[model samples]
Target: MRRPRSPSFQVTPKGERLDSHFISSLSRPFYLLLAITTASLVAGVWRWQASPSMHGAIAFVMIWATLDLLFLLAALGVLYEKPQRRSEPRAWLDEELVLWVEGRPFRARASDGSRLGIGVDIGFSELDAATRQRALDLFHKAAIVTLRFADGKVLQARIENRQWGPRQQHLHLGLAYRFANIQDERYAVDLAFGDSARLQENLDRRHQGKSILGALAHIAVLAVIEGSKNLWWQLRNLWDLAYGAMGRTLRHGKTKELT
Candidate 1:
């Protein structure tokens, strides 16, 4: 008689899933933006001292404050832009053992009876050619799914990596939920690949919309900053001219009085 295999040896969602490291990658830029704001404020104040005029002081304060505010707001945008937690190759499995033991995690379903995260670990090795194509089609349906944690906080998760290369054989992904119950069960998805080829042109084409929007946003921000550079320089130059003329006049007046 054939022996029953241990469930852990098989590719199953029940195994300990790896942790996602995307958040760590994002922290550096987030903190750098904050540091830039602080530095700009200090430098702006130092430069403001050179003016010594009432209007210059006001302008310095205003511009300095504005830049600092812009930096801060931009930093906040970066800081708030938390990467959605999910399982990837190095993904995290929420292990609040107590929560699972206590049954405290909340899970709901869509209008259809499909459980929020209830998934079956179907392997590529098991499927025939026709079924394999169908599986790949469903992988193409992968999307960035958003979920709310037990605390009601929301998070985003990418079902498929947009940058996945054509040469890749199988699909790897992470599922993340914000404020997940530490005790909730961890899941895994395994796709066995018999043949690896670039799936289709349409899969790659589907992401162009997001890419275009991101590009447009970057261009808009760049245009604003580039347009303002000359204006800032002109105001700065006018301040210096006024201050220099005043100092020269005072020196001349003092010399005449002494003579």
Candidate 2:
């Protein structure tokens, strides 16, 4: 006789899940940009004293940098900020499915209930041979189903439909219909969820793979600014506190004599 599966191997029901790492990943770029801007401002200030002619350009950079810093800090705070907990009871589509009407997190299930008689009934009679085979192919692969209601609410659920027997034929059929109606006006499927880490990894790869030309352009601009500072300051004296004070005293003495 086949042995029953251990409790450790058994699938456990999961409650609503939140991706705190995703939230942190979203905010990281802003902090990085802020740090770069701060470094540029410090370098600009040091160059400003020697090259007073670039004061106008430095002031412009400072103003824009300060404004951007404030905006980024505010956005970072808001992104990291947690939403207020809602005490309202959750709406359930079924025992396994929870309706995510609000922006709050909702439970997701691994099983598709269409095979369990809870969803729309679909059979071979409903679909042509080619379509039925295609649907079967889809079932063999892990798929994410996203459903949108008439009221603009959306729900995403992950399922492996291939495990279901003939009794659950409608589950994949319903998924097939939903997939077909994706572009239709009446059926609004917004997004789907699969491997969370894979998605985040793709985003990170795209973010890190900055265009070579774009990077070169940025380097070129910085080079121009630094070059201009170096060229302009070559003809100018370094700002000396004693020299400035002496000049101010001489100007005062000249004014007194004239008076």
Candidate 3:
């Protein structure tokens, strides 16, 4: 199999080294539809202003607001979604390790934004203890990141501080799609939960789903605020017009009485 050339990325011959979490592809059509809806609403707004139709402006506002919300839900679904990994439809692990040497699985350059991690697939339980220990040594030397599977292949690597309070640490790895022969078997791996503080972090994550979800929540709030502003401004304009007419009537009546 042709090996991957980058340190942070591992490419299986059959499986794609997907950058997206899981069902990230599902939102493409959703976002596209939203974009179209948003554009149409904008065009309608312009036409409404030129034609001075209250009904047309109201229709545009309603359509734009509803579709914007639907788009939010779609974004949340796609970004935070994760699929079963082992059942991933790729047949790359059937062959035994050709050479399990202690080396960078792939070459990586250090970037300023985030710390890079090295990913190593550990499916060699059949190998002796010495070899297993040696395989782990490569991860230690460069202070690179690794995803150590009990028998699971290299899934993915991420940029993390790799600290778990005073002693243990958390591993930030990417999810991989491994194709297994057994059709009935489900692909799942238990992720570790760390210290009390880390436990809180995990709990928060569980409630909110993931980082992507948190971001989505923030975005949704902003959109709501903006939509509220649009509705409020329309109401304000009507109120001002009503008050102006009332004041004009009172002044006209007083002038007529004086005359």
Candidate 4:
């Protein structure tokens, strides 16, 4: 007899569903439009074959369907501009952690983490310019960092990169692990990819995207506004050139008459 598979190895339909609900919502309209257009075009061709007198009716249907296909293409172009989140699993932390840089401590929160590295947002609220600069410089120099977890586990890491956001409100650091012990490595792995469901939920929340109609409307409005602006500028430039040429022509005519 064959043995039953473990829960972890079992296949679940829900788990294998489409990546995002918004993608389904956006795609349904395209599929529906394509189906309708194909049916209409096919029917028109069939009717025209049966009765040649129906040529005008078939031509009208063809034109209408072609316009709809153009609209569908425009919708797709707009969808391409929408923001897409990374598919890689990541764990985000709500509480802050303590990071020791060259014996000086700074508070930072774990923004994102993977098996490769951890990204932190270090706050510089109470520190002065020189102190903040010192901290940032230390982090940039690839110095060793000690992170203290809420559970009292200490992990050592080295800075991989650093970035400062808007007005230097906080500093972002990308830290690579320099594990001194086995427990720390295991803890980091567990923190990175241990909870797949939790990470998926976080990803889904970021993908709260617009529906098909909303996306189409947004694209249409922006296109019209931008097109009008370009048209106005082009016409204004043409008018300026025409006016300047006319003045030059009149001046030349008078100069020739005087000569």
Of the candidates shown, which would achieve the greatest TM-score relative to the real structure? Answer: 4
Model 3: per-residue Cα lDDT at residue 250: 96
Full ranking by lDDT: 4, 2, 3, 1
| Candidate 4 lDDT by residue in tens digits, 15-55 | 13233322223644665675687688788778889989878
lDDT of 3 by residue, 16-131 (tens): 34443443445456555655776766777776677775776677676766657655544544354343333233211211222222444422221111111222233434546785
> How close is every model to the real structure, measured as TM-score?
0.21, 0.26, 0.28, 0.47
Tens digit per residue, CA lDDT, model 2, 100-136: 3123222323222221111222234466778667655
User: In model 4, which runs have C-alpha deviations exceeding 4 angstroms?
Assistant: 1-89, 206-209, 213-259
C-alpha lDDT (0 to 100) for residue 201 of candidate 2: 56
Local distance difference test scores for all models: 0.42, 0.46, 0.43, 0.70
lDDT (tens digit, per residue) of candidate 1 on 196-244: 2322332355444557667756655643463234234444767999999
